[model samples]
Target chain A: MRADTEQDILKTELWWTALVTAVVTAIMLAIIYAGLVHHINPPSNIETVDPKTLHLTGEFTEGNLGTRVDGSQITSRIVATQFAFQPQCIVMPANRTVTLRFATPDVIHGILVTGTNVNTMIIPGYVSQVHTVFTKTGDLLMPCHEFCGLGHSQMWATVRVVPEDEFKPGPDGRVTCDAR
Target chain B: MALAPHPNYSAQVPPRVDDAVDDVALERVMREVPSGALALSLLTVGLLLLAWFLMYAFVFLPRGMVG
Candidate 1:
């Protein structure tokens, strides 16, 4: 009778352990299901500017900012891979918000808008967003915040803000670099 | 002459059941099972969570902008 009682105890203990394991597994699955079902299905992106606003996109080549500045597109001989990121001195209308989508192909960079309320990381696999209204009309330097390489300390670009009515086109109907 | 307490003790006795347990082998198995299982399970769950977060933030985010 004693041996029978011991065997029953062992069986009961095993059953209890198995029951606990099954309950824990069920709880984990329920949590994952909840996350998959209601956790914002996915992330989202905001169109922070209109189509008429200035939009620049290109590869940062070695030597200059590799973007055309002709009537067709804003192209420049500014090679960025070798030299610091020499962004064009943009003169946005006062009170107009400019949303610059900074991107890099080689390494991570930072778009630091001096004397403004915007600083962001420009990572390779991530699209960093910086939105700001030009409340004042002056020159703003875009400096690299992250220690990218040997020339990181001096890496920067220029952004020029101007009054609302001072923005005009050049002789060729294209907004030249000096139009502001 | 004291009746010898059944001198055929070895003749009619059932074999002794070995009830002694080896503590060393039990300790080794006890130490191995939980550690190995815990390491593998945690690694699998962690990787799964990371991939899920990245995909959700980047890929699906762009598509949601359509509507």
Candidate 2:
């Protein structure tokens, strides 16, 4: 109730407010820096496809699921079925920007590559795409994080990242783990 | 002498001891308590910020970029 007590409380409140603002500003700045400098962002590709006919035709056909290089662009397409990725293993060159496109014919599935920032959800009626450059040259586990069925734990694949010199494409410009 | 009527029982109740501090003492208490609380709050927030920055720099940054 005293003037001095009220003044002190007001000062403390002002200091706390300033500190909170500074912390929020610092977090925003950090996010902006990551976006501008490191190019880190969330995967938000929204392409639709019929879940029933996903495997029958188009880009998700069984024969077309793998790493394919078209000129300067490298793309890998995979279909997430009940308990496995179509191609159990995929080959990609390290330090190159690659697009990973995923679609699920059964249920909602999500994938996260170990030790990397690549994480996205593969919905049944839509395709999930992630663009990333793998820096580490090794096999990274890509596990289906969303539990779909009794075999969800076994639903995983391998991302085989090889050196640029070792990434050999076949005559059709497709690369697979078997050719390694 | 004759006993006084009713003996003034209501007046015999004791004053609250906690509220009897002088102005100077009350001022010191008000000042010290909030300052101590502020110090504790600042330390907690500082440690939280430190942990967040450490994770961002060491774990998240080195994981590489994806979009």
Candidate 3:
């Protein structure tokens, strides 16, 4: 009887161990499949810019800090300042790949778009970039996730994702919230 | 004639009568498999896996592609 009980315990433990291993393997396989098929990955761009002159003579200039279409590529350059994001709002087309580039002239800041996988941190000297495709069409809240200052609580921007037909850029190939 | 007890004498303690029965019960308990515990653990793990899959499918997958 003692030997029987020992065998039963060993069998049960082995079964549970196998089940746990299978569960973990399943999760890992799902993640790998998503990455290979859907191109889902974390944003890890390593580009540098001078924070002192970031706003003076670069792509992050005040006038260039919005969505612009260059040929078939859509890129939005944003500057996360001490308390607010420049432009305050950007417009992009749904179901199209868009590149969001962020830089900060002050302290560290981060942004995450609501209901989307667009999240990145903006360092003073580093340009954070995230390429994503927005499927839903609406004004999604893009909030500053990092605490910058006393006004950090109110630091947020809007991401207006419109339909492909309604995304009409001006002659300069730029789209802004005011244009909508 | 019986000898008289000393002033410091004490009575001997009696042994337990159910000692043999207790040993048998202990062996029986030790030999039994803990099916209830296994069932509970399996149920908890199953629920956790279900929750993870649900979030992955409904929330994470629907959020679209990003890099």
Best by lDDT: 2
- Writing each residue's lDDT as its tens digit, candidate 3 over B1-67 gives 9999876555454655765557567666765536778788889988999999999889888897999
Candidate 1 stretches with Cα past 4 Å from truth are: A1-82, A86-88, A169-176, B1-67
Model 2 misplaced regions, further than 4 Å: B1-26
lDDT of 1 by residue, B28-47 (tens): 66556656765676688657
Q: DockQ of each candidate's interface versus the true one?
A: 0.04, 0.58, 0.45
Chain A TM-scores of all predicted models: 0.52, 0.94, 0.89
Show pairs that collide, candidate 3.
none
Model 2: pairs clashing at backbone N, Cα or C within 3 Å: none
lDDT per residue for candidate 1 within A63-173, as digits (tens), equals 233222244333222223323654555445456544455555456677656655556665554445444455667788877888788888878877766676765545543
Instruction: Please give, for every candidate in the order listed, the TM-score of chain B alone compared with the true chain B.
Output: 0.53, 0.68, 0.55
lDDT of 2 by residue, A119-164 (tens): 9999999999999999899999999999989999999999999999
Prediction-by-prediction clash tally: 12, 0, 0
Cα lDDT for residue B60, candidate 3: 85
TM-score of candidate 2 versus the correct structure, residues matched by position = 0.86
Docking class for candidate 3: acceptable
